[model samples]
Target: MTHTSTAQTTTDEFIRLGLDVLDTELTAIDGLRRYIDADFAHACELLLACTGRVIVIGMGKSGHIGGKIAATLASTGTPAFFVHPGEASHGDLGMITAADVVIAISNSGETNEVLSIAPLIKRRGVRLIGMTGNPQSTLADLADVHVCIAVEKEACPLGLAPTSSTTATLVMGDALAVALLHARGFTADDFALSHPGGSLGRRLLLHIHDVMHKGERIPLVDESATISQALLEMSRKGLGMTGITDAGGKLLGVFTDGDLRRILDQRLDVHQTPIAQVMTRQPITISADVLAAQGLKLMEDRKINGLFAVDADGYPQGALNMHDLLKAGVL
Candidate 1:
């Protein structure tokens, strides 16, 4: 009864099309379960036994998938790289070594560039693992190990584009990398080591020292400093809190904006009142090596908004506030 505009119809059609593509890919990966033949195990075994690296080679769309798999493997504790099959004939094949394992991928299993290097890879004493839709094709026939990435059909309406086949290949590569990761006892720390420039790295590698203000820049004062002096220090450092230390430089308490408000409510004179009178005694402090996320958790659990960084002798050495977390993108 309703007439939809062409734009709206196109929008709906594309959304449905994308969902169909994802569903088709899921089904293809599920189908791989039945093909759990010895060929798959043999491929993994050859890669695991390799002494050097896993070199991935493919052409066209399959080449794109191979490149992504290579990057994934490289970042996940497995040494790998993608060498375009087209480039292998252009002198880049010299990058290949006898100690490497070769993974050749093709949907038709007869890509000329990929197949051309199969014999050379074998002649160099490298293990050849093939991922293909056709188990009987030339590339698979020449491989020492064949992995079937057969898809029932393409997500494309005409079954022309590579949708399900690429998904199956990616899933297989992930399986290999994760299995090898567990075999090598790779950990989250190891992952952080490989990704030290990203936010995930910052979350894992950052410590209190990296974010907390230290030295004279820290917001700190002696117990004898007046409330007015502490507030000045807090404002100067912009951390919203000041650490109150004893005569021996040991952490005695902390004074924050909250404490100031409470003192003001009691009509306390800032200029004459000693910071010790309004400071929170035995305030929660963190060590220099504490993680930023852990620090956030500690503050949240304690119902506090700030922290003092302390040393081995309970002496305050640095100060941090909620704003610091926000600035560091940890909030």
Candidate 2:
């Protein structure tokens, strides 16, 4: 029979226990700020000097954290990946090479599977970086560099579970990645290159010209065109708006589908009136080279769903609507 702790039977006691776990972790993180030393510096330098990819290896909980760290590093311009120590002993060790730097993770620093292949890693002339709670562990002693991720207490109430230790290890990994990112002078553009399918990549990759409907495909009419003619152009282009331009292609104003509906509701003469008289003046426009994502923001910010692409001299060159943004996945 399992012994039940009477103290944990109450809901308030359970809540306090949960809060205590978070408190311990928060306190440990706070202390980590001042613990930065030469080891952290050396880890960053070692990774910077690496000529090949980083091969991260760990077991159990550390393995999960290692995978995430590898993914973060890879996405942030550092090429790294996780490998299971158990699988490495079988055949995955072939993936390791002399040019690569190995990051070994184990809280106890004495995992049998990890230590079993430690010799082969060194034999292959691979640099080993150990992350562990114990400073004097065998893994640390055999490593070229050791990053201590020690925690004062476990967040687990049982105290035997990995909690604060894993958090500290993850923090150390992030610290290394950010340090390397700055050292390499990694920029947003570099990050966008790796995340082409993401919204951020869309913002960086797309420009106004790419989405803008140009040439005769754009809904456009001259200032002299009647409201009926402007409505026809708007319908033909299906952009729900028509731009008014002069003989020199300079934009004068815009007539939108909303304007047409409003005029019709008031029983205005569409056939007898000129579009220039009723057009919206000083309309919002964007440059062809402006980012499509920025164009989308402009539309949202100004409470408009469409924009006219204008030249440097304010001539209408292209047009786009919210549908274009949706198609480009910028919305």
Candidate 3:
């Protein structure tokens, strides 16, 4: 017989434990595919028909997942909020209305705090949707629709803690949120409206003019300007590039740091070289009203770090670089 100390355990043994846990949880999630039938469809229907917010309630570990589910629902065009089941019996149950749908989460379907308010929720005529591991428990029996998140076993080696179960619950919640999102024809713009404080909002809402430098701040010079003058303009504006415009202010070309590198490689005299001789002709430009995200994509596709915003007639309106997008939270 062989014995090993905890410190002497090989790396392979430690990794095997982790891989086994992951395999167990993955199998648990796969098992849920069977439950995504009629009951799942009905659950989406119930939530889609909800006229008011979805009130999510659970105890302990379930509470944490409930909070995340509620946030996902709210952000994806469904109105929702989390209410502690313990607080519900103490009068928080009043927060629920007949028009609202209540989603109660309990692993065993026998959590006393949740069951305590089940009768109250039903008495008020609010639709109840129960998410539990045991479909035969009191919570499931009383629910209008039950979502079974039963896992074969917990990922925990002890077979006691909520591991695979919680992950399954979260996946089920995402399924509900996304199903409702599609049924409601929710668009990315709608999503941005809900997440106005995040980068997504900026990506969807910010326009070129909002982030681009205009007027004096725009690095511009006439096509006839010396390379030395172009460098001075680029340095003063700090955009690492300068736009060359014609007599009527229509953009003709652009000189960038890359062009400077090319000139240096060719040993051209920056002091006396003409800007028009080295500038990139009819450079790719973006519309001033387009989303900043489109501008970033254009810059990425063109393999450049900066670009000029133009009007309908191709006259330069503003200039911006990758840093501008970063500064405006549009990147």
Ten residues in a row with the worst lDDT in model 3? 2-11
lDDT of 3 by residue, 59-163 (tens): 999999999999999999999999999888888888999999999999999999999999999999999999999999999999999999999999998988999
Tens digit per residue, CA lDDT, model 2, 1-84: 898766536788779888998899988777677547888798888889999999999999999999989998898878999999
After superposition, the stretches of candidate 1 with alpha carbons farther than 4 Å from their true spots are 1-14, 35-41, 296-305, 323-331
Judged by TM-score, which candidate is best? Answer: 2
- What's the TM for model 2? 0.91
Candidate 3, which segments miss by more than 4 Å at Cα?
A: 1-8, 198-200, 265-273
- Overall lDDT per candidate, in order of appearance: 0.86, 0.89, 0.94
Which candidate, 1 or 2, has the higher lDDT?
2
What residue pairs are clashing in model 2?
none
Worst 10 residues of 2 by lDDT: 4-13
What lDDT score is found at residue 121 in candidate 1? 82
Model 1, 1-331: lDDT tens digits are: 9976665557788898889988988999999886677877777677777889899999999999999989888888888999998889888889999989989999999999998878888898888888999999999899888888999998887899898888898888888788778877888878888888868887777777888888988888999999899989988988788888889889999988888777777888889999999899998999988888788888999988888888889987677877787788677
- Write down the lDDT that model 2 would get: 0.89
RMSD of each: 3.9, 2.4, 3.3
At residue 293, give the lDDT of candidate 3.
96
Error of 2 at 69 (Å): 0.7
Candidate 3 local Cα displacement, residue 113, angstroms: 1.0
